[model samples]
Target: MIYRREIDGLRAAAVMPVILFHAGFSFFSGGFIGVDVFFVISGFLITSIILEEMRDGTFSLAAFYERRARRLLPALFLVVLCCLPFAWLWVMPEEFRAFSDSLIATSLSGANFLFWFKSGYFAPEAGEVPLLHIWSLAVEEQYYMFFPLLVMVMWKRKPSWMVAVLVAIACASLVYSEWASRVFPSANFYFLPSRAWEFLAGSICSLVQSKGQKRGSDPLSLLGFGMIAFSVFYFDETSPIPSTLAVVPVIGAMLVLLYARQGTWVSALLSTRVFTMIGQISYSAYLWHQPLFAFARIRSIDPPPLIVMGALACLSLMLAYLSWRFVEQPFRRGERRLLPSTRSLVASVSLVLAAFITFGIYGHDTRGIPWRLPAPIKEFMADNDWSKTCLLEGSSGWDAMPIENCIFNGSHAQTYAILGDSLASSLTPALTKRLDGMNIGLQQITHSFCAPVADVSMVPHQARDCGAFNAAAIEYLVKSKVKTVFLAASWKIFFEQSRYIFNGEEVATSDVGQRLRDAFDKTVGALTSAGIRVIIVYPHPRGDTEIAAKVAKLMHKGTPAPTITIAQDEFLQQSSPSYAYLDDPKDRHVLRVDPAKIFCGREAGRCDLARDGKTFISDKVHFTSAGAEAVADEILVALRQDDIMDGNGVAALSSD
Candidate 1:
């Protein structure tokens, strides 16, 4: 195949937005479509190459694979090598193992399937791994493995019938993508079958361009570029992806490829040195950017500022250029005189096998660190032995347990009902400490992922479990003499446009606020009318980055012990703008607490190792047994202010 500067220009078009978007630049939200564009381009170019070779009877499976290895492996191996020191130093034992396995998966060209089963592409866990982007490369490599053979067979049997076979395969891939996107979104996003249609779109372009007719005039190419530009700016992460909606980018890419011939303005513009330079190093740029961003976030426990992110982008480009020049170009020279094809193939296969063997054998054993803890902190985390604690009914089952477990157990314990979602459950260890110390009996009930926001407008997934669990818990409260009901959960997840109705009704537009207020009133009234007081518990401030990153940093530092810390007021300030989506519901019945002041450090605004010479928390969010005991003073103050707790803990105690 002859070189086309326009093709390189097209590459620039596809990759720049992807780099920008992944860099956390808001202007290129839809830039993720760049992957789809690349898929199409790969399909067209590779298919064209295969078809030409097959026509002349020069197509050999060995040769095809060699070319692919030359094109892909050199740069990829270099990337994995560069990540070694960082993975060793910065990543935790568990994460290091996962990264090692991902490295093997990438080398074997099966990373796509591995990632699909492991985590969603957008998942914080998956995003943290340096090799996450290798899934796309795996998809392409897997495609080449089968596609060349299929084309060769069909072309030999019937020269004119290959198109029909490819069309059928493309259709099948599209169907799989559409179905899987709904059922297994993570799988749908990563796998080759779901992604093949985009490539097939490009393959069809190869057939079209080969027919000796130009696609259209300059107007069509300009229109295509316009459509692509619009999509890149407007689309976002929330958009249902790799589904029918993906046609926008696929179509735009086809148009640009088909009509971008010499002398056209579209071709002239895209073929410039600046754009062409970006295209040449596009592959390396894609590989380098994610790990850099992820590592920065892991180290800081916060995303870098835009200025810092921009600097990283510039650094990525420079690294990409170096990789392209030194690593990629040198390895791609298919000079059999120096390194025979057989030897090169054996070496590549050996490297791939070594990576796989090492990862598989060592993956699990990598995290075999011993758990040694100080006597006190160890007691706090593991106290109330799992064997002895009144294990709630159905806690082991898929069905949710009631909200009664949030209370304490004691002779004089008051009637305090606990309710909320998983966030609420995570807080149970801390809450239990305070209530247990106070000699209070507790009844805790909670449903997984079901935050206790009464407003339908706030809830997401319109989760049936939330509605059912709350309804049953309310019924229990109405029948019992519960004096005070304590409500706690991750409130931010619910109170936003993120709400999705399972019933399929669009959010009620005119009365959304009123409806929210009414729901709150009904929820509160059900308890209060039954002579029960209500206490709303807001969550401690949290960083948006994955929690594992924070834990891993401590592990890397070889800490003698774990520490508990609260986010600073300044950190809270940084997060507050996102909270406009979360409307805080503070009523006379609701008692709010900003524990950061008492729990966090004075200067850093972080939860300190010790507060006033007293250890306040065990970990970042959960309070230590001692910390929980200390919080009894604050809990009492809030309860007294709300007049929910009586002089004696009798009514509350009896209710429990």
Candidate 2:
């Protein structure tokens, strides 16, 4: 196959936006479309190469795979190896284990599947994974594994029929992508089945170009650039990508491949020295950028400053240039041989695979090398069992009820209900302890991200039926005739943020806030009408710091812990909106509890996250076991003061 300088320029176009977007630039919100562009480009170039080899009757699957290994593995393995030391030093144990899992998966060309099971591509946790970008490479490699064989089997057929076959498969893949984006978004984004259509678009472009078709200097190439530019500028995290909307950039790339020929201005622009140079190193640049950004994020206490991230982006380019000149060029040209023969490439890959597989097993079996940290830090870092057992997740709704070992004093006549998202779930440990041996039964109904407010939709994360889940919990509470109900959530996230991802779209916080208020009003009204007392737990003091990690870092350094506090005024200001709906003068049965008031001193005007040398909050918001106990003690005191519970521990309502 001939070299296309214009193609290299297109690569530069694809990589820059991705780098910028990952660097947290708002302008590059739709910059992720660059991956889609790369998909189309790969489809075109790889198909073109395969067709040329088939026409010459010299195609061999082994030779094709060897070339792929030579082109991809050297730089990729170099990046992964380089990331190890930093991951060991900076990443916490569980996260490091996940990184090890990704390393093993990447070596086997299965990172896409590993990541699909882990989290969404755009999730905040993805920013901490050094090898997260490898998923795309894995997707491409998986496609090529079967794609070449399928092409060779059809090579003897008429060209038009082959193109028709490609088109048909592309259509089927696109339909699947559209449906999957709605139903299983992470799978749609990470998997090859939903993504193959983009590559097939390029395959069709290759077929058209092979037929010697030409529309000389036509303006369609310019239109193609415009469409790509539109997607790059306008698309965002909320876009249901790889769906029909992805057609814009896929078609744009197709147009460029088919029409941006010699003498066309688009081709001339792409062939410019600067664009060509960046394009030349685009592969190395892509390999280098993510690790640099991810490490920077992982090592920071707060989000790295924009200037610092900008500097890191420049450093990534410099590193990419060096790798391209040293690592990539030598290996591609076989000037510096890592293996003596072509067949040795397989041996080298196998060795690397075995090493990573072993590392993954050790990492998992040892639970992320727990000996690396002090026992206290390791204990703190470990996920509390309550998170899994007490918290209900997914679309199962109320079917996850009757959480064994969760319901306490079940045989007692007096029943108290705890309801809300994970914040409410955190209360279970403390609530169960407080009511122990008190002859009071507890019904805990908790779902992560599903607030107890009725008829409000949680965006991007929760199912659309979250409102239905809340309604069901409410019905269960009423039917069970629970005497008191407690509700909590990370309300600041919903009411204070400027925007939120909802149903694969960004919605204004104001809109969701209004809906929340409406739901809260209706929910409270229903509970009060049913003669059940309602306790609305106000937002707790929180900061941007990860308290557990911060404490661990302090312990690692063998230094006295630094004070971690959030100003009470700031906390109140942030949480004020959470209670605004309760200002209605007619509201009677609902009572509010401010945890900050009990947790922090009025004179200090700040809430301390660490008390007597132990971290109270786990992350930014959820309470630690001790912290929950403290809050629960205060709640019990309030219950007694309000006469909701009598001196004998029976509900005051027993006489009503």
Candidate 3:
């Protein structure tokens, strides 16, 4: 119920790391914990206010809601409103619909659930999702919607039972968080059921303060600061959220609240003028940063440099200060308050809600307003035929895609198959059609993110082991007596973006290179031992930004047919591991296909997103149907030159 400059300073602590983390700073990989910190702060402040109001017999749900509305809604609505023109100019149709979905959900206080449902393997990258951060506000709003009611009910029945009720619910939520963190990690991360414990931790902290401060000391505050700092520096994305691992930060926040009193160094540090200012603007800072980052990525032709990203991060803070003053202050502070009464606030808020909801419905139903772009740019994205065919995301692991039409019909008893992750499946449709003329039926087998390797897994991201997926593919191929297998994946991603494991223990970061060497050797060995020929479909040329969206954004702004170009040397550097290992396999017959050569060779040192006015690379590494078809032509060339498939390409089909 009392203002604490230290708490505001604590807000400064929570918001900066989140902005930096979302800006792709690896040092702040655990920066997402800032949201949990915010949860604790919110629970404590809101609960303290409610309990105090109840004690004075002056609590009104209508008044409480009006305060929440004034505090949160106006600034949020302004941010969303500003994003509209940018979304119009930049975001592609399907992506725009998703943005619209978030818009509607955010307006309805359901963004967390929408995001959880939408966060599949194919979800857009965090930088491309403009309203992604709104999910946190949605979570907090949902918490308040229920938490106050529970507290009120408990207070009416018996004042002492409120603390007990909070404790019991918190314990149950903690247990659920631990169990769900392992089993339903995405759901656990986004939804309220698994996150209630973090809020309840703050609720209990409020109750303790109410009873009276017995032993507030600097040591406890220092320990709390130490715990918060430890979690921030020591934990990473691999850490299960809000599990026992998260209790450190939650309890740390509680300790800080309980003991960071006047005269304590921690309190003094948190109560600084700069920290309170940053804290005062923190909510607006959080709202503004995601859109700035997302739009910057969407609009840039190349990956925006770290310096540029840093500048944008600063710009967000500047914008936050303005938003806090102009949009947030007027609604809450009352000197020049636009809505001075609850009636006026309700009417104004309802109208804004209806207008935004209508905008969301209109934008979504119009499919992100396709008519806003030239037909050529619109057609270019719409013509993604391979995107609809034999996609890795469409398959359950190791299941044979019913592509009997694509099977290789050859002179020999053995047949052919394609294997890898989604990248492999992207090639299947184009490879299938290319070989159809040659009567070579190619069997299609792939899975999402399932690197076509053996005996290793990307432990943090993989729900099922990639090793198992590859194992099943190898077994099926061997049993089917396939003659040659073409292995493909986003090799650059596996080598760089993922964390690896061998034999159930994490492969040391230093040892990942050697572990991958061993895995590739085993994979090639198993197939080669079966008398099956192998062709490595090396990773395609990668663009720094999502290419299609970037091009569309440029075109909408009257830039003529812009393209994303990456240097060949840079591609090789990014993908050196895949190139070196797969290109010069120990087995001489372990052949390879290079997408970099096909995509990058034309521009001397640089690779273009399209060739001959045909767009190919879809996002970063995946291919368009036209691009896949071009790559298929190269595969055919390799087969003929290597004398694996005869130059005279006609053969009869065999059901055997």
Q: Pick the candidate with the highest lDDT.
A: 3
Worst 10 residues of 1 by lDDT: 384-393
lDDT of 3 at 570: 85
What TM-score would candidate 1 get against the native? 0.71
Superposition-based RMSD of candidate 2 using all C-alpha atoms, in angstroms: 5.7
**Deviating ranges (above 4 Å) for candidate 1:** 24-30, 60-66, 92-129, 145-194, 214-249, 263-278, 300-311, 329-331, 337-417, 452-485, 497-534, 546-633, 639-656
lDDT of 1 by residue, 1-656 (tens): 87777778889888888878877799999988889989999999998898788768788898878777777877777777788767665655445667767876876788888787676777655557677888889989888878877777887788687677778888888888888877666678888888989999888888778777564559878877887888799988876578878888888888888997887888898889988898889999888887887677656544578888888888998999999988777767656332456686667668666965575557546441213333333333344111113323332322433332334564564646666665455445556666666565556666565555443423333354455556666777778766667766555545433333422344633435555455556776677677776666544555433233343354345543445344576546644633432234433444444444455555564755343324443333344344444444556566655455434432221110
Return the TM-score for each candidate structure. 0.71, 0.80, 0.76
Clashes in predicted model 2: 0
Best by TM-score: 2
**What lDDT score belongs to each candidate, Candidate 1 first?**
0.66, 0.79, 0.80
Report the error of model 3 at residue 445, Å: 7.0
lDDT for position 514 in model 1: 53
- What are the per-residue Cα lDDT tens digits for candidate 2 across 570-653? 877887887585444134566667777666774478888765456667777787777787777767766766664333432212
| lDDT tens readout by residue for model 3, 320-417 | 99999998998888576878988988888889888888888987898777777678778866674345344444225335533334354444344578
Q: Hey, what RMSD does candidate 3 come out at?
A: 6.4
Model 3 per-residue lDDT at 359:
80
